[model samples]
Target: MNPSPDLSIIIPTFRREAMLLDAVHSALAVPGLQVEVWVLDDSPEGSARSVIEGLGDPRVTYLLHQPPTGGHPAVLRNRGAQLARAPLLYFLDDDDRALPEALARACAQLSASAAGVLISAPQPFGDDAQRVEEERAYFEQAVAWLAQGPSALRVVARLLFGPALLVCSTCVIRRDAFLATGGFSTTMPVYEDIDFYMRAVRQAGYVAMAEPVVARRVGGPSLISACTRPQMLAAYAESQGQYRRQRGWWEFMALKLWQRLGR
Candidate 1:
């Protein structure tokens, strides 16, 4: 059989067809490389299926799960990873767009650091369409920190309780490492990415932050980040509890403070 494409961009989309289309266009525009795009539709009515099919791109694969399994981003993500034709997987939001060299650069980074199981980058974008200067500066710092091996203490201190840990869409992970980590934690109502990242870092021996690979388009109407707060917090607390049980109570308490402080 012929080889699979080099990368699989998995997008878990609800109902944002227009933004999803824009996202697909950006993925298709990622310069040079054969890649597959999977759209995991969780919408009730199969709304985005036609739009995805109309793209007519053989590289695109759309999967719809109706009356969908709720709180299964991890399950959907694992399904995407399983269907992917490549050893490397990139998780993209339905509303995000890749920058010009995002995929190519991520592939290069993975190749260079065969030791790294997960490679993440900055998602540079603004409330407006244009890139903001502050975002650019922050990205530079993140890249530098990742290059230096952000450290176990740092990973625990910063990642265990920081805004930095929750952004899963910016991450590109190795297929083996993802599977080994048991994929995403489906049981957690929130902080699944945090749980996954901690496990991935522990298993992979290394997680590198490459230069910004994606230009994530934020400030949209249907952002997952814009989810209602009480629900989000409740989910966050549940995930935090899980992390505590898995790790330790003291570590969990420290992490909880970080969350409560809005860190």
Candidate 2:
């Protein structure tokens, strides 16, 4: 088996077959980059098999869960990381399309920087698209006016209280950093990305890119859509404060202090 590629793009899917094909096609089409795309199908029917096989691109590998993941996207995501060969991991959803240039840029940034995670600005689409763009822009611009301290630290703090940076589809993370910090949360069904990515940022800081890398399809058949606003908020509230209670919290702080005092 081919062991290591420039980037490992993991897409976890349930019912979105056609969109999954689009997502995989866009990923495989990334120019001047070698990517291993892992499509994990959590659908019991294994409906994605034929489409993935028909693509016949060695770069794309499909796996059907022997028993479905019971609606936990995090389980499929974490399993992909365990099996992926690349040193860098980019998690993309079945419905989102990747912008080649921005993705390549993200991989390059993560390769050069020591940061654990790198996230690109997202281009939101679908219903309330304009509203989504406005809200995200407000946070990105506000990072400078509302927060103080180091760049990554400010981002960490800003997002911890509320979301400024989102869409894990646009984020690239070093393999070591991902393993060290722990991947997405298995227990929490909704807002699992929030729990996981926030922990990822807090551990080793993050690289925030301005250009949009992912054409995110919001207000669609996604986790947020499946849950009510109150349910989402409740899940966030229950898990937000607890994700940080991990083994590396103090070690991360020590490293931060050493960096601060070094100069």
Q: Report the number of the highest-lDDT candidate.
A: 2
lDDT of 2 by residue, 1-263 (tens): 24558888899998888999999988887776778999999999999999999988899899998688788889989999998888889888898899988889878877888888886666767678676777567546644443333455545544555444565676888888889887888877687776677678778777767777888776666677788888877777656446445535664454445445532
Once superposed on the true structure, which residue ranges of model 1 sit more than 4 Å away at CA? 1-3, 70-72, 126-141, 163-166, 222-237, 247-263
Q: What is the lDDT of residue 128 in candidate 2?
A: 83
What TM-score would candidate 2 get against the native? 0.85
Q: How well does each candidate superpose onto the true structure, as a TM-score?
A: 0.79, 0.85
| Pairs that clash in candidate 1 | none
What lDDT tens digits, residue by residue, belong to model 1 across residues 54-131? 988888888996558664676678788888877777887777787758567767677577544555665666675444
Which 10-residue window in model 1 sums to the lowest lDDT? 217-226
Angstrom error at residue 251, model 1? 8.0
